[model samples]
Target: MRAKNSFLLLAVILLSGCFVSKDTPKKEAKEDPYEINNQQDNRSLADVLRKYSSLTIQGDGNNARIYIRGQSTISLETQPLFIVNNTNMGRNYAAVNSSINANEIVSVRILRSLSETAIYGEEGNHGVIIIKTKNANK
Candidate 1:
């Protein structure tokens, strides 16, 4: 009887230790509106931007359009903080990203609300279009 009791106690302790108090990381209270992951370049852009193509994405495999708002422009020298792979993308980044390299993008996220705009400060006055690539790596 004592051996059985001891074995039961030991099992209980072992099982108790294995259980974690946390429940699914407690789920964040609230996520930031603009708190986004590192924008990747995993898009399927097969066609390059040609003449006067309205800002259209994820349409056909051809005719990709690169988006750039005026507020993102800085001192006429640098454009908006084009962030990609955590690296500030240059103007060429759009050219390269939109070029018919691999495939067209899957989708584009436009953040215009003050909640989203406030993060970028004045730089996002014109608005912000977060480009998410289709197949690009992080």
Candidate 2:
């Protein structure tokens, strides 16, 4: 009777161990490029571009030239195509630099790969700097 009771208790303990809950490891969420951060306030568009490892900025301020590291300039235009709020601002860096403030930008995306820039056609060949302003719809 003592041995049977001990065996029953052991079986219950083993069964309870098997029924224990296990925590499932969670998958990390991917970072979104378009997600605007509150920390970017009062910053210039050029300052934001500097954060990217694939980009190279030459000169300073209004004369600043942005270049994608691996891409070669196929035409006389050295600057990349600037698209602000879906409007093509051409290859003129000054127009984009002077018009848009850093604080006004909701998101800044650089399309360097041919596959990514192909949608913009020939103008995006050198690469493309797409800026989404807070008042994009306005």
Candidate 3:
């Protein structure tokens, strides 16, 4: 009778384990890019990105390719458009961002939505990272 009771108990425990819930609510992922104000250290662009969110910065130094959340392009070029002040830096946008001193920057705004980036035409498809410097001509 003792052996039978132990067997039944073991069976019950095994059955209960099958019904246990493994689906726990996960934390809501932040889709928006964080804004950094009062620019302090002249840290590298990749460093600034790493400090804010869980971004994937592939490559070295200022030449790194930054991948923003939910931003993907059909073309081979996955890099986002880097706009300084009111002027677009064209193809070498990433280079421009790396060369600029972080201390000289006043504000960094990220335009993620399709509507927000639509104004710039196809170039804005990937996403628009607008960096305003302290001396930017408004």
Candidate 4:
């Protein structure tokens, strides 16, 4: 009876170790800042621009024209200048739309304020869409 009771106690101890408490805390999954959540792999730069509240996109796809909402343009050109990885892509939206891949984009920033876009000179008079890609050196 004594040996049987000792074996039962050892079995209970081993079983208890296998079970986890329901109140135990779980580690939460961390979100990546550069990640564009719920976006498709084939998403275009125009699709990504729609996510931002400060800008407005007219039309669709390659022919799409982007404008800074609530910001007055100094020039007749409504299209904002595109700066990709510190390179001036001019005001042509079709060229930029085709050249850049949405998956390679790290971040997209809009320089709407005059003070913010003054560094780019006359080209930035309307606004600036600064695109930082994963491979900036490329």
- With candidate 2 superimposed using the best TM-score fit, by how many Å does residue 11's alpha carbon deviate from the native? 26
Q: Rank the candidates by TM-score, best first.
A: 2, 4, 3, 1
Prediction 3 TM-score vs. true: 0.63
User: Which candidate's TM-score is highest?
Assistant: 2
lDDT of 3: 0.71
Per-residue lDDT tens digits of candidate 1, residues 19-137?
Answer: 87766477668854433333445534323221113333334443333443333344554333344433434444345454423333333455545587577776555445554454446
When sorted by lDDT, best at the front, the candidate numbers are 4, 2, 3, 1
Report lDDT (Cα) of residue 5, candidate 2. 100
Higher-ranked by lDDT: 1 or 2: 2
Candidate 4 residue lDDT tens string, 1-78: 999999999999999899989999998898654355544788888898888888899888898989888767555788
Give each model's clash number: 13, 0, 0, 0
| Least accurate 10 contiguous residues by lDDT in model 3 | 31-40
Give the clashing residue pairs of candidate 4, or none. Answer: none
Which scores greater on lDDT, model 1 or model 3? 3
Give the candidate number with the greatest lDDT: 4
Per-residue lDDT of model 2, residues 11-69, tens digit only: 99889877635685677898786655758556666787788877898876788888877
- Model 4: ten consecutive residues of lowest lDDT: 31-40
* Model 1 misplacement above 4 A: 1-87, 90-104
